[model samples]
Target: MAVSHYTLPSAKLDKPAKLLIVAAPFYREIADDLIAGAKAEIEAAGATYELIEVPGALEVPSAIGIAERMSNFDGYVALGCVIRGETTHYETVCNDSSRGITLLGLQGLCIGNGILTVENEEQAIVRADPQQMNKGGGAAAAALHLIALARKWGGARKGVGFLPEAEELRIAGELKDNPTA
Candidate 1:
């Protein structure tokens, strides 16, 4: 299989913006690295964050829901590691957690899903290291991107809106036709 590559845009996060992190302790080794990377990124962005540890990936959604409702955080990050075994449990956990995180983001919450679903420990190792693949850092970057997009579009205090570049150009064209009218 070919290796998949991705790049994230660099954006400055709003300083002092509240952040909440929910991590799974089931895969302690990998989880630790992920948390470390995410924390470092959040701090580098000049934001303050709190971490809540859950038993495993399955419990992450409830923890996130509680934190989101309790604190006025601008964004949330969910970190976990699930390596597939010879059982169907892996599929359930991975799918449910992903769906839960997506729902949270859709509910006007900025969430960075750092959950790593890999085929084995080796894959997890590659993605969890702060200095290596850095999936955790990637999650933090995604959170910052969503936060910036939210601010530019408008806060959740108001409903989300979309104004495409082409739409802006069309409006400008109409305005120019009127001139001083």
Candidate 2:
């Protein structure tokens, strides 16, 4: 497994950062483990997080979307477990939830998706354990990296669009005073 070679990304933000953790605890124990791992990672990075629980994985992304639109979180962590079952429901939940999270990320949201689409509970537990795969922590680290990148480049300006309103007004005034020149 590539697990042996995987290294967690180191992150340190320039300013205090707050994150929103949206957990879909349909599998309560798995979710708890994931949340624990994620919290440890966020704390270690010197960041704060607020956690909110939804019904299941399907709702995780929508919760994040709402938070992103109405709240002031710097990043988001999506935690959940979708264990494959006898019915096709597993595929639906897994695909839809993943697609939703991906769409949100594409829209420029800093999100760490820790939702586990596992074949069984054993796999979920193993992946969620902080000492093992620690997928939860990995997700948080991913989000932190994105957040740091956003902070680093988010303020940079290109050309005309970034000109301050005051500067634009000053330029306009100069143009008006020197109409003939």
Count the clashes in each prediction.
Answer: 0, 0
Query: Compared with the true structure, what per-residue lDDT tens digits does model 1 show for residues 146-175?
Result: 887888787575222344555556656865
Task: Count clashing pairs, candidate 2.
Answer: 0
Query: Which stretches of candidate 2 lie above 4 Å from their native place?
Result: 1-3, 156-181
Per TM-score, the best of the predicted structures is: 2
Off by over 4 Å in 1: 1-4, 158-181
Candidates' C-alpha lDDT: 0.83, 0.87
Q: Against the true structure, what is every candidate's RMSD? A: 8.0, 6.4
Clashing residue pairs found in predicted model 2? none
Which tens-of-lDDT digit does each residue in 71-156 have in candidate 2?
A: 78889999999999999999999999999999888777889999999999999999999989998998899899889988888752
